[model samples]
Target: MESQTVEYKSDIPTKHKLFKAEIVAFLNTNNGTIFLGVDDDGTFLPEKVDQYKQWESWISDWIHSAFSVPVQKFVTLEVSAQNFAIHIKQGDKPPYYYKDGEGFNSKGIYIRNGSSKRRATDDEVRRMLKAQVANEFESELSNIQESLTFHYLQDKLLDNNIVFDPKGLRLQNVDNQYNNGALLLSDQSPRVTKIAVVDGLDMSADLLAKKTFSGSLIKQVDMTLEYISLLNDTKVSFTGAAARVENESYPSKAIREAVINAYAHRDYSLSADIKIEFFDDRLEIFSAGGLPDGLSVADIKEGISAQRNPNIIHVLDKINYIENFATGIRRILASYKGFHKEPMFIVTPNQFKVVLYNRNYALVDDDIQSWGNNKLKTNLSDAEQLELGFTVNQDHNLFDDSCVTELEKRLDSKDEKIIKLLRLNEEMSRKEIESYLEEAQTTVYNRLKRLIELKIINKRGQSRSTVYYMKANESK
Candidate 1:
């Protein structure tokens, strides 16, 4: 639980100054509940009636006079047996203090982080103050055509045939004081500034292949899907001693999701444009924004959904362009159900990117086959293969011997995807793998459970929506 959910005690020095400091601490931390009038040992014994009234008055008087911050919003209460529960919520305003000429003197400015109310270090206080000011000056945009429709999303994205309402989209109940609203809804969106994309493996290539999407949000949606379609439909030929081979890794859903997330979660406040770049071997989507507050690519397994643009998310979820509060990173990992190569993510100071590589090719079908051949090898059935080709051909990349050497360093030989994914890309999602790798859903779950047991990965979240990511063997 966040710091804001505490059972209070009279043992907490209800003297005026200390009481005010504690209340301020709770607000700074996670908004928490405080129980008043309860003795240290959980007894319901009330204080003397006269003293109780005086204590209440003292509490009220100090709160009004002591804190420069607004007390009304942060403090909420309920009472039973003279025991009270006071709720203090986390505030957007920071560097808030309990005052009276002794500015941060004995009761220095404190911040609640996790469960501890530590004195705010200079850096923490500065960041909080900057965050407050940055939040206050967010840009606002007008002239959005209400009738502008995203019907075009349905036209270009073929793998998932979803429909949309002709009516435009809106983000309701957004706390404008803390959110960057206009940048997300603008027609140019990520296109306002020039976009650049790069291969994760090769960061220095100025002339690398890149594409741009133009027009309204609907038009941009179409443009992005059009680029994704090129990847989905592209085929590369590989020649083997056995025969000639053609490979098409057409899991369009994965590309769509990566693109959608780039648009939906990217920090539009930044000047950089969104980018879709295809490397010789991988496809990458770069969004200006890094992961939202308190989230990282590792959070893929955590199954946490923190959208930078809830209004945009609202419309995307409503029209089914994206799943409602669904985690996209998890879905991308699922796309590699029968394959060995996993997805990757790279996070930089102001950007977050998702990368998917072409599936590795194997010379013979059996060569790429997993340990279990019959029950779970490939998505294509015998009849499907027959229809696909009477003369099947195959080819494969040279085995990555270095990965094996890296693997041997492990005390135990466990080949879990979540582990493999982290080794390649620190952020991999178990839920995403489950969603895309539908055939191996149970197998993935079991593998994750075993990894967690072995303490190779840490599991978080609840139910079928849980997330799994790498954990140090010693960390657990």
Candidate 2:
């Protein structure tokens, strides 16, 4: 028997190019398949023998040499008559582009955008290119003594808190002119490579409060975390219904490791900034690069050291920013385990995002209440729900603010009926929700009140009116 999975497409030409781009995009970004010649959209164009044979040859030719690198593509027949499907799978090397019968096509590159084909933007193209480049630590940082300002770094470290011997941190070769620069660990050295804070709705220039570090990367990291701490306001609840609020879940050590790894592993040649997203519940740090070659998520867990930037690594070592030679990831995991939660380290082509989930001790003591007649679907606490809400809000590509808030509140209140309704249409307002459930305004308002108090749902608008919505975390 033949494989059931194949690339399926309708008779729509515009959609065909989009699907080809989608298949190409999936091959470029991660890996997936695209099927063509299927009549799912009711445009069942019968396959002709001569035309089918010609198209097959053309597709084969396109797949082999039409991309920056060859992506996998396969064509096969369906079980039905005159119907067929094509499968375009992803390959190991990413950032694949099509020749476009002339020059390179960037926007034409398609990726799976939730069951649809969407073109990649210019930013995505640059990210892909960075991912494709092979980075070796020793080879790049060999001539750092000559290439960068090592003396200035030493002075900065002495002036700051980093008490280390400069001789141990100096680059060996003084002759080579192309060595990667180093990061100093001094009180004056700014450990954060970059800091970006966005206010209001969109992540636009007007809403963004961005800052760059001029000192050594180590100091910049320290300064960035200090600023992040200022934004973190913690609130704790007790079994007696008493609430204590302060700056908690601010795991300084875990954050320091995350920043160190980000600075040490970032692709310096790239222009994107290191990202620090501060919200009400949690913080997200995104380094502008990914894991080094031959290193996977599993390898990171193995506590192996494959330094991507040797110059920066050497300087950090001297200052004790890195405690163990090969135990950064392990330490981070262990720290999170202590809190009864897991720290997330995500690997993207152009970014490494870390999430330090909040553990509200007070909320943990209380038993989880179900929504809609006691359907306990998730094992998340009240504080976890708030963290999930923050995660959903910040992740714009996944959901909007309203969706996440609603999901959390419904889960907390044991309102299962509303939870399913929100799952189908996340943007539903209080009125729409009332209409859908055929309930009274007072009931909906009371449910929404419970949600807001729990931090599961956030209220937008003002006066004698409002919109009640769920957060992305609620869906989970």
Candidate 3:
């Protein structure tokens, strides 16, 4: 009747060492209950349950004193008329040792091999060390303890006026050894970010560029962004009375946020590197591990952030690199809020990925209408149309005096200036525009009113909080 998670004993063991191993096995593996008055056949013997309270106290005290760590918290003794159950929950810290006399032995460590407890192997002991620091992985001692440097990260901290204190940053643990956090931020870190820019839409396309960035993770992220910026091309549109709209192929903020998210939350235990594939149609950032245990795609989309590597994110937050708003997933979605092409988040048991589509994917010769004869324009939003770089009106040239000259005449120098200012900033308050324009309040108001009527600019909010921006109804 006994299984991996359930054990029955007719009565308490005569020796302390025998029963202690059973409790340790439960802690190391999945938690199990040891029933005092239950036999192997699941037969209850109330006569065998004599002195239950004394036996319970004796077992609890022996476990607290015999283990290498304070494991009393993981143990619970439940007493009822039915039986005495020693309930041991799976421990957060592993390698729970049973001391022989005053000193602990490697053989003292036990795990549930099957239904029975056995001495753990050397490899299992090492794994237990990792589990001990699971919540703060950066505090785990580095594999390479010698010759680690943090020049790049040091300078970053210096620029931000923070002293380079390894102990203060938790780059070193209690033993004063350089921890995994220090290794990652050091100049000699083996971890690297790999990026492949495909010339075409998929991997079958020729390789336009391929790069590997190494050194400190902070440096790697910056270097990767710099290399990708060459591929993040911008398209300029010169039509419409509105100032020429200039947009990047992909949102810069979204790209950076995704990279940071991959870096901070990735499973460092895996040897696999962070891989980014840059294609004409989309960018996919593949991190080593999948979503944290119990996290779902919908939960992540709603800005629920679970830390797989808490210390790595903590360091980034201290450097002011983090957005200090919602999770990176939310910020990435915000970047593509008004676009038809949005980002996709994919997860497997061993992988987590972010796929961002190019906002300009539907453009042909910098014109959306020319792409399949405006087939893509049927359901596109104002922001999507703006990114494609064209005016809705028949007059293609915004600056052409003869083409839509009536509309141009209506937009005098002041209206043109307002439009130009709005183009620079996606949205500006009436006060912010007036501060920059330094013109009469009545004159600017009249120009803003006229532009809104023409729909050259859109007004949002009300009274003092009201803001005006080019390409009307973008928030839609």
Candidate 4:
């Protein structure tokens, strides 16, 4: 109803060229309605009722010859003599221009801007041309060597009971000439996916481990998931009776979906690599390029998706890595239902990031040391140490030397408390240790199990009668 995509004119122009620019603008834009006898303020005043038939004949002939494709079907004239409205729908084949003698040159292209028509800029014209060719960069033929192999992708497809044939590649927009999507799925794709484990919440701390997974996109997704699974430590909890509860550092399903979504939807035009970082209390996955055009975060939250790389998505879906399009975010959120911290998403024009919290490690203050070697000292700043709930002494030795052994060094402060209490009492039941430490029964149980796994302490008996003690031959 507003004048944004609608325009008004006092009367049909005698010189038809005066209104031809407006027609080209509407065809190039979202299409619009033009009222010949309406004022700019939207007041309808019929002035040229007698010339309606002549005006319609002239407009129909002009549009048919002006555009690259015939657009007479897009125009409609109101039959009512009291109101003259010519409706123009957006052209399916864009970059609509005036038929000048030069033959579709820069001078012909017009675009709608606000309430006026203007000549499209060179860049705008180029973009329109690209859009006309099916908005997919991955479908374009690649200049890379055609002697390419997709051994990894083939194996995955074979396992899924699907034949990996050359014709299949063409069907999926991949041909003998390797395209961008084919390059990504090739056995020797140069794109590398990386994961880095840091000693602290920030990268300023020491790098514990850094691994790069490359080659085919399928292999990279598989290898990355395997590597992260190895790092997903499990925590234990004990209650009234001896209970062993397994707590995963990060939800397995969420990590898989995030990694696959990153590879599937990433903008390959950008050379930036996908990065997965592990911190003290969270994990961050950064993928180059943001949401696709016309898509927003809210749209993704509602399970709406616009595929920026349809070719890549097609291959990924066929491999069964993606069950459905637009369901990755919803699946990621569902995986964190019982988790204390929800996943966070940060989207920008050129980048998208997913931040997942480590709920198991959330309450473990001294878990930061797990990332360091036995000889490594705390590199955390004074403020960071305080924030982590650690009281720094002048000596800077947060843990007593007597409480740390080669195997027990990885244990957190609470685990040390349980060990100290056990050593002092020689042997203590689960209830006795929980009572002495005045800690949550679940916390005590997790610590006790961790100590046992480290062989720093031994648990004897079962159920409510279970008691823990340090190994007799082991020295503190």
**What TM-score would every model get versus the actual structure?**
0.53, 0.42, 0.54, 0.60
In candidate 3 the C-alpha lDDT for residue 474 amounts to 76
The number of the candidate with the highest TM-score is 4
Reference-based lDDT, each prediction: 0.54, 0.55, 0.75, 0.73
- Candidate 2 lDDT over residue span 1-476, tens digit each: 11222234553364445435655755654433444454554244665333566556656766677666654343232333464455554444555666666666675665555555567778766655565553533235433243244444555567656644434455434543333443233333323355554332234422223456656565576667666654443443332223333325656667778777877787765666677764323467887777754356887888755666666676666666675477777777876675656888888776778877655432433323323312232455545544544110122323344555445444543354454444334345677667645567898778777656655456567754765556643554
How high a TM-score does candidate 3 get?
Answer: 0.54
Worst ten-residue run, lDDT, model 1? 393-402
Model 4 weakest 10-residue run by lDDT = 392-401
**Alpha-carbon runs more than 4 Å astray in model 4:** 1-135, 171-175, 238-246, 338-341, 365-476
The parts of candidate 1 lying over 4 Å away from their true place are 1-31, 34-74, 92-109, 129-200, 204-208, 232-251, 276-284, 290-307, 314-320, 333-349, 355-358, 361-476
Worst 10 residues of 2 by lDDT: 390-399
Q: Write the per-residue lDDT of candidate 4 for residues 418-459, one digit (tens) a residue.
A: 655554345788887776567898888888887777666787
Candidate 3 residues 1-476, lDDT tens each? 78888888877678777888888888887678888887787788888767787787787787678787767788888988777888888776677878787765787788886678888889778756654444456667888887988899989998889998877887887777998878988999888998876656888865544578899999998887776665675666545455666767789999999988888878777788999998778899999866653357897888766676667777788898885454788888999988987799998756889999887676645453364534354456545666776344332212332424345448665566666556534578887778756788987898899877776778879998898877533764
Q: Of the candidates numbered 1 and 4, which has the greater TM-score value?
A: 4
**How do all the candidates rank in terms of lDDT, highest first?**
3, 4, 2, 1
Candidate 4 lDDT for residue 239 = 33
lDDT of 4 at 194: 88
Give the Å error, residue 153, model 1: 11
